[model samples]
Target: MTIPPCTESGSSVLDELKAALGSRVSTDGELLQNRAHDRSHHDWAPPLAVVEAASTADVSAALRICHEHHTPVVPRGSGTGLEGGANTTADSICLDVSAMNRVLTVAADDLYATVEAGVMKSALNAALPEHHLQFAAGPGVDATVGGMAATSASGTTAVHYGTMKENVLALTVVLADGSVITTGSTTKKTSAGYDLTHLFVGSEGTLGVITEATLTLHPIPASTKMGVWSCPSLQHAVELVVKALRSSLRLTRVELLDRVTVDALARYTGYTAPVTETLMVEFVGDRTEVESQYARFAGLAAQFEAAEHASTSDPAESSRLWQARHDALPAALALVPGSAPLPTDVCVPISRLPACILATQKDIAASGLVAPIVGHVGDGNFHVAILLPPGDERAREQAEELNARLVERALAAGGTCTGEHGVGLGKVSAMAMEHATALQTMRTIKASLDPRGILNPGKVLAAS
Candidate 1:
């Protein structure tokens, strides 16, 4: 994956790109090299060049130049991503889209928002209070809309509002040949040709480069309530989540945190866990409906051998509880100094989630790994972050073993290796094992759309 000074096209192509982009393009020194890889602990291999795109035009023009030069272009967002989707190799340029963060249009009437792909999710949520409308795609506040769409991200709201695959209405994409195409419609659902919008949603920037997006919005809930229920163990928490999902109550968000994770977070952050495990649930609606929903959920809680149930309607208090959940990654990372996480997202059927959790917990203990677990239990998607210190070869190997066992359990339960996080370089090997048939088809699509394989080469599908 190392480029030999781009001999295929030579210096003229590089000079052409540098001339057109000027200061926007750069060759790797040290800073550019740092931004090339994502949050993964994977080995760093910086791109040959980096481009800080300011607009859709910049992206399209860069793609055109790369297409002609037979060079690869790697699209990047905020680089907050845990997966290795943004990692770069040789003869490629990192298309950094962070500088293009602009909210182009906010149609309150249409209930849709159009923004440059660099727009952050937290900024969108912050700007929505005036209209009482909010964007639903929340995949850790640090993620960008473009990154979320590329990975088909989903989080606490997924059980109700659905994933980015459902939230994104359209995308302005620059194809491999620099031909631009718009997918999906502004008016919601459609019976369109090939559903290309979805095709690229979780394609992880292999099929095309996403420059801008139109996203769906929902009315902010009139009254929102969050609660914490403590359980005996991670298994008990998963059981409670399953029961809560099966109940008549419409839960907005349901998340599970294992004993190991709670203990780690307690040691890292100041917050203490009420028990060995806990479930954070949210109920949203009008004043009367929200209270009624809580009552109904409480009734179901009693049946699940509930150890403790705590509720808070105050926005400040709810935010405090959520702040801890939202900061789970950073807090867990705090426990391990000078180390990166080997985070694995595994989702299973509701009936199988408890089993998967139990198996994962046992596997984690058996593998001699330090894995703290947290997940969106509402839709049976969860993550186990394996902490590996720098130069700890044994820990890395043990973490890898646990990862394999976790995915095996999920797959045996008829689930995927990854639920929200896309198959970037970290999950690429597991994806091959889990999706042998679909993997070839995905490669076929990549080959067909990007004939020269100049768009994000060696990602999602390794070079054939």
Candidate 2:
């Protein structure tokens, strides 16, 4: 689907967009170039213009106009996505919802909050602290609520709280043709029509644009504990985590950082993390519950030959440790100067995580690539940061081939190609292989919702 090049007559569409949206519609060269690509390694492709949508009406109107003119529209929020979901195409209009950053309502009693699509998860959490509530499904980065819902993201906390798909109770979505629909409801359950809210949650903007979301919130845990345990090997670390995951303990966060990642984080952050395969686990609950769970976790690790198990209740210390985990990607990148990082995520069954990760580590060593592994081992999801030179085609190809083989191995082990990172431009080929005939069903849905393929062209589904 090609958007016609701008002619004297084609300029009318731009005029209408500007006239309808005032200064919100911008064709500024610098802004266009800046918003071209996301954190993904997808090559830049600037949009014809960007519309800073401030309201659901603005989103509807913009989409209505774009729909009428057959202009591709790429919905963007915060631009923190590691995938190329928000990256614009050559003839597209970037619909940025960052200006719609408002928390519409917070029903503390109902344990839900309604927020505009552009509300960042960190901002919402800050606001909810007073109420002892938190929106827990965050994707590490300060991503927008709408974007999180779009990509179905989950992070360290997801093992306990759940993913965006589970946390999001409802959504205010603008369809491709500018029709507004409220999916789900303030009530917990509904025996209504299809689960449209979920359909759009992980659709990656190919179906519609989410303008607002009503999300389920959790009460801030009464007591929380953080601990790091060093294991003899990656397999030992993963096996210990799998035991905890299967237990009745309510673990809030369980992460694994390989020896390379641990070394990198220690060097970059000046924090003295154990220089070995490590498992970082956090438990949240009542005082007694947290203490008991932490004890059980330690006991389980002891069976697997745990080297060290140190637990802490200090919030400040816990934050410092988790911050190191968050900084792993950047720290690893710093390890290989002047190299572009290609981050890939895969999830396998808990029982296969050890084999999958071990095989990947060996594969990386044989390929001679400087890649470090980090993971939320509680959920069997892990990420590899492969460093490739900026313009080194051979290095990029090697990284790509490694990524493919890793995904294949994970798939054979009954896992997914991508765990949280949505299938943007980077994982299209993997999606084809992973989904097989089911990929056609996705294409059909994409066509049904966006017949012209004007919504996020060249995303999720491969170009047919």
Candidate 3:
């Protein structure tokens, strides 16, 4: 929805925001245009202004200014989201919180850390090495902690450590009317009242603007082991993942890459593995325990006809292997020059993973679309990145159709349309289709929290 420019009112609102924030406010055309969109393929609609919030107070003051003018405010982090969660329309205030990046407190003794909203995940982990503590939830992108919490992000390590929803203990949020409130507590367990912390965790900025977060941290692994196994087929690789997941191996991550993806990785990066279905597995614990886990994993792989077990315990070697997984998307994109990647993910029961992936592969082949498959198969989550050639509307249409069918297959298997990526503009229809009557309840919650709907309008719920 393109909101017409409120030239008169927008000028007043910008003036007011500048008055409140001085040099922090910006009405620069290029800056507003750039802040209006994220990594998604969504069309950009530039906001009226951009506010670089340096503190929680700045966020509150900015929100208050927009609230008084009945203007919409779209909160943004690093703009790394693949979905259109951070995209904005005209006449809206683009609140960039990246300036607020700061680690507030690190309670190593208590296994938690509090940070201002804009702290990047990699920076937090880097800061924790001296304390022998690390934030376990790892997304592929170096996203802001606030954005990770807002999207409830999970990645490779989530198969062991869990998602942002589990790691986050509390949050400092600035409500629509500039009211500040803290949700959750420092304690690990809390049943004191409504789980407001969770309500905003995946709210995608519809409920409030997250300013700070208290997150759970875990001790650095004493011993780390990683390996890559070659499988004859996708079915065998998935079977091996299920077998490993069912076992007591203390698995840290189990990722899968199809033959095409492997080829792409080999082409983009010098890291070459067997150009077949492969599983990258990791285990962390005491040296003896990690070795035992790898031995057991090797035995299971052998049963599934998986060969070429390349194992590593050295930190440098382990990092090199994992970097391949993190660089999967870019490598796949490199395979098809001048193509826009449409990445979508879904999660299903472990038992349904094989069938879901196989069927999706068949659908991709039938549509003749270029998509490479990769997944965190340990937890029944995977992504099908569709590479649509430039100016090929028909190919884009086919990819869209394939995506819908994949979602349907996942839904039929009792899974979500998205596992880690929240219901941004891309999945709003899927959310409604998946939730049915329950969606009304979510709308009620959104309405209650943001009455005027000035907070990130047209996202999560819809344009209505």
| Top TM-score hit | 3
Give lDDT tens digits, candidate 3, residues 118-217: 9999889899999999998958789999999999999998989999988999999999999999999999897799999999999999999999999999
Candidate 1: residue 169 Cα off by (Å):
1.0
Model 1 weakest lDDT span, ten residues long: 1-10
The sequence of per-residue lDDT tens digits that candidate 2 reaches over residues 26-136 is 888888877777888886577788899999999999999999988889999988887789998767889999889999999999999999999999889989988999888
- Please state every model's RMSD to the true fold in angstroms: 2.2, 2.1, 1.6
Candidate 3 ranges beyond 4 A from true positions: 1-6
Prediction 1 TM-score vs. true = 0.95
Cα deviation at 264, candidate 3, in Å, is 1.2
* Model 1 lDDT per residue over 39-124, tens place: 77666566777888998888888889988888878899987667788887765778898888898889999999988889999888
Name the runs in model 2 displaced over 4 angstroms: 1-10
Error of 2 at 3 (Å): 16
- Model 2 clash tally, residue pairs: 0
How do these models rank on TM-score, best leading? 3, 2, 1
